[model samples]
Structures are given as C-alpha cells and as structure tokens.
Target: MTAPSPTPSIDTLERRFSDFATLGEALDFAATGKRGLNFHDMRGNLARSYPFSEMRSDALEMAYRLIAHGIQPTDRIALVAETGPDFAALFFGCIYAGAWPVPLPLPTSFGGKESYIDQLKVQLQSSDPKILFFPEELSEMAGEAAAQCSVEGIGWTSFADRIALKCELPVQHTDATCYLQYSSGSTRFPHGVAVTHKALLNNLSAHAHGMQLEATDRCVSWLPWYHDMGLVGCFLSVVANQVSTDYMKTEDFARRPLAWLDMISRADGSVISYSPTFGYDICARRISSQTHVSERFQLGHWRLAGNGADMIRPDVMQGFVDAFGEAGFNARAFLPSYGLAEATLAVSIMPPGEGIRVELVEESELTGMPGAPDRPKRYRAIVNCGKAVKDMTIEVRDENGAILPDRAIGKVWCTGPSLMEGYFRDPEATAACMKDGWLDTGDMGYLSDGYIYVVGRAKDMIIINGKNHWPQDIEWAVEQLPGFKSGDIAAFAITNGGEETPAVLVQCRTSDEDERTKLREQIRDKVRSVTGMNCVVELVPPRTLPRTSSGKLSRTKARNLYLSGEIQPYAVAA
Candidate 1:
C-alpha cells in the first residue's frame, strides 16, 4: 500500500510494439505452426481437433455467413450456449465480422418457459442485439421469446449450420468491436463490457507470457463459458496460446465431481485448472468416496492448477492438499491468481512454483476493537493469491483514494494495459470506476510482503455496532464447526430503512430438530467469538444457497431472496 512507484506509461509500450496493428494479425502470427483447439465432449466420448489453419478457415467462413445474413460490422449479436465448438465459432465469427457478440447465461429459472421468456425480455431490452443465435434445441423457445418481445430480424440456426457455411469472401477489418461480456447482473442492472481486437490480443499476450503457457500444455475445465473466468481462462487462453483443451459441462461436473478428476488423470493433463475454492472442496469430497478410490487417477502430471473467480479459501486449499497429497499432487502447483473481465482475463498470477500462502491476524484487530496486538500465528494452511502479473500494479487504498501501508485492509485498485477501454455505453459508471487509469476493483484486501490477500467485496463489508467485518471472515469461522461443510456458509448485511444488521445464512446437512438447533447455536457462537458481533443465523438445506453459473456463492442474490421473503428464517432457540 505504500505509494507504488510510477507505472510505466501505456504510451511507452505502444511505441515499443507499433508494428502489430490489430488482434487478428497478432493472432495470425501467434497461431503459425501451432495447434489451435482440441474439443473433448466427455459426456459423448467425442473429440475434435482443430489446427490453426482449420480454425482460421472456420472463423472466416462463419464471418462470411454472418455478413450474408445481414449482420453489419457494428451490429450486436447475442449468443446463448454452453462451452463447445459452437461457442468458439460464434465468438471468433463476431470478431471476423467486426460485430459485437454478447454472451448470456443459460436461463436459470425453474419457472419453465415463462420464466425464461421474462429473463430474455430483460436481456433483449438491455442489449437490443440485431440478431440472436442459440442451440437448435433452444431455437423454438428463443424464437418465441423474440417474437413475444417484438425483436426484429430473428433467425433460427444451429452451430453446425454456421460452421457449414462456405468461406466465399473475406471481410477485412482495421478497427472493430470484437465481443461484449455482460456484467454478472448481481448488484444492479447489467452492462456490456466491450472488448476490441487490439485490446483482447494485448491482454492475451500479457496472459500467455505471465502464465508461461506452452504449446504442449493441455487444459481441462468445467467452468461455465458465460463467465469471464470460464470463457477467458479455459477457452480463450487455450486458443490464444494455441494449446489443446477438454471441457466438461459445469452441471455434469457438479453431479459427479469425480469425473473432473478422472478426466484430468486420464488425460494426464499438464495444465489441470479451476477456480481456487472449487478444486479444493471438490477433490476433498470426491476422494473420500469409495467409488473414487477404485479407479486410481494420479494427478502427478497436473501442473498450473489455478484458483480464482472468487475469494480463495485457506481451509479449502488445505483440504485439497491433504486429500490429494498422497496421489502425487504438489501443493506448489496450486496457483492462486487474480483477474476480471475488465482486465481481459488475468491481471496477475502468483509466481508459478510458490503455491498459496495464508496469514492469520487477531480476530479482534480486524473488527477495529481494542484487544491484543496483531501476532503472526502459525496456520496449518495458507491461501496466497500470488503477486500481480508483470507490467501491472496493484494498490490497497482507503475510501478517499489515499494508498495505505502494507498489512492495512483497504480496497484493491489496479492499473494495467489489459484494463478495459471502459464500460460499454456507460460513461458515468466507467468514470466512477476508472479514475486516472486505476480501476477500482471494489474488492477488499491487503498486501503483505508482495503477496495479495483478498478479504471480501467492499460493498459486502458488514458494519455492526461500529466495527468492520468481512463476510468471508465470519463465513470461515462458521464453516469450521461440526456438521458444517466447508464453503457452505454465506454472510451478508441486511438493512431495512436506515437500520442495518449482519445476517448469517448457512446450508445445513440435516433438518432434524436437534441438528438444526445445534447448527444455529454453533453458527451464532462461532461468529460472535470471532467478531464480537451478535448475528442472526438461518439454516437452509444443502445446495439451497444461491450461486452464480460458475458455482461461486452469490451474496447479492441471497440477500435479495431474504428481503423478498423467498428465503425463510429459522427459529432462534429460546
């Protein structure tokens, strides 16, 4: 947090590489003599390999067909599909045509068709895309929604159809919009994040160089394609690096976590990957199953296991290491990295060989109470998110923008070439976030000895009786209690009118009267012991906690559900 030395000017870097004009050109150069993509559909036992030549050809053909279908250079197209060859074709197709491709989540409502239609209406109103592309299975429903919304120029097409289209012409582009990534739509309305060819290529160059990815590295992931980490981490990074990758559907992985490990082990994947907390808990749960032990899968070959997309949990990491250490997995291979869509994927990666490091501070000091001074406590485990990537700078700053010294908790702000140009079509929001080239990430954390430690989101910080508390800190405390699964707790602040109180919600393993009572007491006592704040605890069934597509808990959604009465509160013990 000390006033960081001045970051090198972007202008200086621009001058250094003035030769390359656009992303397509850079990609064309990078792809030379490199294999592009290897698609593995584990569910269907299908594998398809695309060399760079074929990929470029496919991209160009899709671009020609899109233009023939009346898509203009600046027109917007919305894509609703999972991670697969189709998604890649549509994304690169948009780039080729100089149109913007907006990736949307698969409709998540249990209300069936009507719910999907309503959600589509919201997105259509915000995006106003000229055309919509979806899976053939979803065409009828999407077409009906389009008609219902009175969206013009609607066409039903399959992924195969798009790929089959001939490459009759080539459309040249010097400057054009490539893709549009929508915000998570968690807090407020979602805005599109516009990424250009040049920006994307520059960011990819930085990422490939930072991660030290090689052409022979193979990637296997179950992250959703709609999210930035999924799209960029697994798909784009592999393609940009010209490596082979296998993708498993996220739901499929959730239903059978062991399959993820089986695939990685079978493939002998060099670059096995996932967000931090996901790999840890998934392995911890799966390895304990008798079925998982029968078919032994050695993870010794797995390198560059990444943990990102949410707050990296220390216990989760330790759980993974303890569970898999006997199976030949190295703790040092777990790379706790950081990035956002605005940064075009990865901003910084922890040094490759040094896994994760955790710090323990006196709980009272964190809550702003006058107690024992901070002491270095030995943690059986640590969760270090690594350091900032080369050429990027990170700072912890107070609310007023003044940088704080190391070990002082504050907002995490970053400045780098990979930062987004700005929020698409939202100048005011853009201006608020991007000041003097520094992106206010809204994440809370501190730096200690050149390592980054994320606490929680600034907006998610709970203030009760004049003490600051990170929801993660409380959640961590509750998770350690008996009968609580790791990562099963979510803490958020609930406010009505001008009064605010901290509420703790946990997913319980059992609904038995005695079990429920014990859980409630355990959660309350644990939180109070850690933060000195009395909390109201609610218990729900396992998997009832709200989660984003990528499996990270959504505090915002959980709070909304509580406020709307959709989530019922548990009875407090008298």
Candidate 2:
C-alpha cells in the first residue's frame, strides 16, 4: 500500500523566484525547503515522494561516485529520462559533477524495437557521451545503443551501489555549459543545443514571474522528460522555482489519461498543469455524456492550464471546456505559449486569465502565396501565442533578414539571455539558424498588438506553380472526414514528371476494398476543397505515417518515405 504524499506549504523557507547564479545554487537553496516531487502510479496512487533534501544528499553521492569513476568536468552524460527518482537524482548528479547532462527520450509505443534503437544510436553518436545512464529495465536497448556508439552504459540502480568518495566538486560559473538539449523530433541530423547555467536560470526566473506563480501553487505533469516543454518547463522549472510537483509517467498517461486529472484534483492547492493539444483532445474524448464530471474530478483548484509543445487547437480547448465546465474547469485558465529548444524553452507566454485567442487570416497570407482571381478566398484561424517573455525580444523577418511590420507574416526570430550558446559540435548548423545573437525560429508567424500568432513552419509549406499551400490546411480539412483524426494524414509537395503537385498520405483503417476506395476519394475531395487543386491522395495502412518524438506528424519524413517507396499505398480498384 502506498501512502499519500504530504502537501508542502510556504511557511518554512521563502520562495526565491530563481534569483541564483547557477542551478547548483538553486538546488542548494531548494534543498532547505519542504517542496519536492511526488510521483503517482497509473491509477493515480502515490508511488514515491522525493524531497529536495534527500535528493540533494543522493545527488552529492552520485556526483562523487562519477568523479571517483573517472568522469571529468565538461563530459557529456546521456540519460534516458525515465519518470522516477533515479533519473532525478542522476540528472542533478551529473550537474554537480560539472558534467553536461543530455536527456534522451525513452522508447515510445508506436515505434518498434529496432526503430527505437536506431533513434537512440543516432542521438548517442551526436552527443558522443562519455557514458549512458538509464533505468535497469531498458538495459538491453540502451546497452545496444551504447555499444554501437562505443560509450559505457550503466543503470543508475547499479551505479548507486558503487563506492562514492567525498571529494571537492568542480567550481561552476553562470556561463558554464549546463547541458545539451536536442530539440524534440531530432533523431535525424540531431544538433544538440548547448545551454549555459545563466540561460537556464534566466528562463526559470522568467516563468516564476510570468505566471505569477502563487505560494499555494503546485504542478502536475504527464509530459515526457526529453522534450523541452517537459524538461525545461515542468521538471527543471519546478526545481529552480522550488515548487512541489506531482508527476504521472508519460506511458501511464497514455494508458489512462484521466488519471492525470485525478492527481490534479487530489492536490489541495492551486494547480498549474500543462499539455499539448492532443493531451486535451484525449481527455475531452474520454468521458461520455452520461458520465458525471463532478463525481470523478474536482478541478476548481486548477488555476493555470498551460497549452504548448504543439500547435494550440481552439476546437480541442472548447471541447475540453464543454466536457469539464460542469466540474469547475474554467476556460480562462488556458495558457498558450510559444517556445523552441534553441530558445532554451519559453519565448512567449500568454498572460493568466487571457485564455485562447485567434485571428482569421487569409490562407494565401499564411502560405505566402499570391491569391488567384479564379479561386475563392479562404481563411484559417491562427491562434495568438501571446507576448514575448522578459528579455526575449521577438521579431518577424523577411527572407533577407529584414524586420516586418505588425501582422506581417515572416520567419519568427528571437534573441535573449535564455537562448542557447550554440549547437554542440555543429558550428555549421548553428551558423545557419543563428545570426547576430538572434535565433531564427523557422516558424512563420505575425505579431499584432504585442501578441504573436504563429502560422506554421515555413519548411512545411508546399509550393507549387509559384503558389504556397500549407499542409495543415489540407490535412485538417481531410481530418473532418468520418473515421479520421489528427495526425492521420500527412501532406507535402512532391515532384511528378518535372511538375510540382501536392501529395497527401493518409492512414486508412478500413479493410473493405470498396470502403478504402471511397475513403480515398473522400479525402481527395476534402483536400481539393481546401487547396482548390487536384491532389494525389494515397491510402496507406494505419500507423504508417511517421511521427516526431513529441508525437507530432512529421510531414518531411512522410514525404521522404513516400517518395522512396518505403511507405506502400494500397491499390484502389478502378
């Protein structure tokens, strides 16, 4: 039987708003407080409660052990970020040992074993870590990847049993490289973003002030630890801000998403929780009309409902509100944010109580394509991602790097103390994205009245015959067809007989031959309604489309595989 975790109050040590020189100093201060992390099982039962005081002692021991085992300062230690105390202690342990901790993703459900190994091997090759630390259960896969990379692999459980000697920890400055963060979905051509202690601390401080995090505020998260939103926002931010947090493993959340809400509801104070659009979408879809929301959840204390890590969907937000409104879920708690790994996490955050906002922009404007007189004007709802964070200046720039005026769509660029030093060991790739201390966030968005509305990634735009078409517009339209959901369709531009045309790869689940053909036509018609041009729609098997590490549809990979004939489409009868 598991015991309930105690609620940490602010009566003991005063909250310091992350006003520290380094993360080590931040942890040193937080160790004096009662706030800590509480992890729950799949059923939302308390599994383990780890306080900062105990974790500090464990981290110090682990740090000494690393040094005693020949680990040196500035060495990179790859960690498979599992949702447990071992990962928590080892992550900070790497920092205390003056080594850069690289958080890697665990194997997801959709990808097969070899696929998972390939992804891990590539990342390990990029980071070239001195050692790989992972949970004992994943030793087989982690060991294979480590062997392929010629790096030592050690499970933290066994490593903890090793002898530790008390020795002087290396002195760390604010500018020292704290860690290397590979952006979500960076398995191919991965470029690790090296972040400094000052940058991480600055961003953590910005969060405390931006959200106006209250004393009674606690956090609940089901996000994976490798993604920036999960790492910098929920985990590291929780530590640097000295706030108690409840965590449900990402896998557990996938199996039983409602358990996330249960944990949040069980907490006694104001709750600050986050999820992408898909997370909200699943929860809203889980409950039926007959199910009583109040009987299961008491969400009145959830003050800050954060939305990010993917495109924010107003429809999904509305669905969630409609489902849980009767149970005290407020619409105003929605917080849409904009960020990237290169920025170290948050670039802009919507103010509290602002909720989700949108603007209907011409489809041509969003795609950077000139409108044709013969075609009807169409519009897409672009969500407002809110104002830039403190010290982070955002600008819309043209292809020539010239700044654009308000509401003029262009490449999104940001520069601030929160930005990374550079892509580790990849100067050429770093130079391509950074200029004059500003990071060119390949996303295209416009600013209006101090609020930013992100359109889409410029690379994902499909240009054919001098007109640009956004894959999202076509994909969203196709998703409206029955039996389809988000990420079921991938749209991109393909070259056919020396001519460019839009190609759509949709995952068709229907087994009947006639139904599959009809479904393909339905998707084609739906896409044509959005693009105003004929599109080649291929009906592939379900789960055939590729997804990023963050579970986002990867149109680029989909296109590559489709063109290379790796993804086979079913034959439709004439």
On lDDT, the leading prediction is 2
TM-score of each: 0.73, 0.83
At residue 66, candidate 2 shows an lDDT of: 92
Error of 1 at 367 (Å): 4.3
Please, what are the lDDT tens digits per residue for candidate 2 over residues 29-128? 9998888988899998888889888888899999999999889999999999998889888999999999999999888654467757877898999998
Give the whole-model CA lDDT for all candidates, comma-separated.
0.67, 0.86
Clash count for each candidate, listed in order shown: 6, 0
Give candidates' CA RMSD values in order.
Answer: 12.1, 9.0
The sequence of per-residue lDDT tens digits that candidate 1 reaches over residues 263-285 is 76766336657654754686686
Q: Specify the poorest-scoring 10-residue window by lDDT in model 1.
A: 6-15
State how far residue 57 of model 1 sits from its true place (Å): 2.1
The local lDDT score (0 to 100) that residue 495 gets in candidate 1 is: 44
Error of 1 at 130 (Å): 0.8
